[model samples]
Target: MSYYDVDAILTDAQKVPCTFELTVPGLGHLEGNPGAEVKEGTKLELPLWLAQMLAITPAGTKPGMITLDLPDSLSQKVTNALRADPRTVELRSLAPHFFNLGTRMLDLFEEEELSDLLTESFKLRAKELADHAHNPRGALGEGAEFLQGLDENERRLFRATHEGAKAVRAWLVGMQKK
Candidate 1:
């Protein structure tokens, strides 16, 4: 057979443009054939080292994860691992996390993952705000408070957040009683 099917989660995100490390699970193989096409596969794995040039390990205690800082050679291996006909790959992304200063809480609610794309797009929006914040302050002072003052759109977003928070608190209260 030219290829075999397997189910394996990505040990880390493959963020190449920026500076995230590239890492993969130590051992991965198809269920039917363990050592059949390793040579063919290893050939692909070789390129990963190149793709993951400026890699770094995550600071938190998450297990079996790597951050892809630069390009990596092993990305092809990740691609190959998920290359079965009619393929299916389950992906989860641990992108940038923001901390809430008011509550002193960690934010884990914002995330998105697809077969090839995993990111927090809001992070970019948030980053843009952070990057140009001082500029706006200098230009219009109070007038530039977009997300901060949050007109109608921001209020709607806050309402959604409040609903989500209520659900989470309900879950927590239920857990505590049990």
Candidate 2:
């Protein structure tokens, strides 16, 4: 992801659960207790940027300072829902930058199942999105609910698809007139 990407920045700002592995002095401000020590095993929701840094940064011979956990958006419940029916899952409700966040998380954690699930989900959703885009009544009619559930990337795809269809139709009409 590019550093200048607003979506990437927003994804990095999203909070994720983290557990402190070791007690650290004057770090309680993260939990709203300023000037206090952050005790071991203290769990708190931290921005992905900070959490990722802390989780990967080593201290002496030990591995990292904190343990990172999947955000609620990518939890097992959501996974189950996607696996059951990807088209039915409202990805925007889960996370506006769902796919982007998933990509970032995949970099830190090795989850083959999640990777496959996301890929399959995107494939299914994109096909459905394309179908809806090509339909003149899709936006305001039956496919409205599905369109509303699209995440950032999918929305862009839908827009592009819809515009392409419109352009093609306009071209055909001009040809017929000629």
Say which candidate scores most in TM-score: 2
Query: How high is each candidate's TM-score?
Result: 0.20, 0.95
| lDDT tens per residue, model 2, 1-178 | 6779899899999889999999999998998999999999999999999999999964566778899999999999999999999999999998898999999999999999999999999999999999999996876898899999999999999999999999999999999999
- What pairs collide in candidate 2? none
Error of 2 at 83 (Å): 0.7
For model 2 the TM-score comes to 0.95
Q: What lDDT does each candidate get? A: 0.31, 0.93
Q: What are the runs in model 2 whose C-alpha is more than 4 Å off?
A: 58-61
User: What global local distance difference test value does model 2 have?
Assistant: 0.93
In the range 1-178, model 1's lDDT, one tens digit per residue, is 1123111012122223332123233323422345443221221221222333323335674422223222232144433533441112221211111111101111211222222221232333334344333343532563244344332222344456556656778899999999
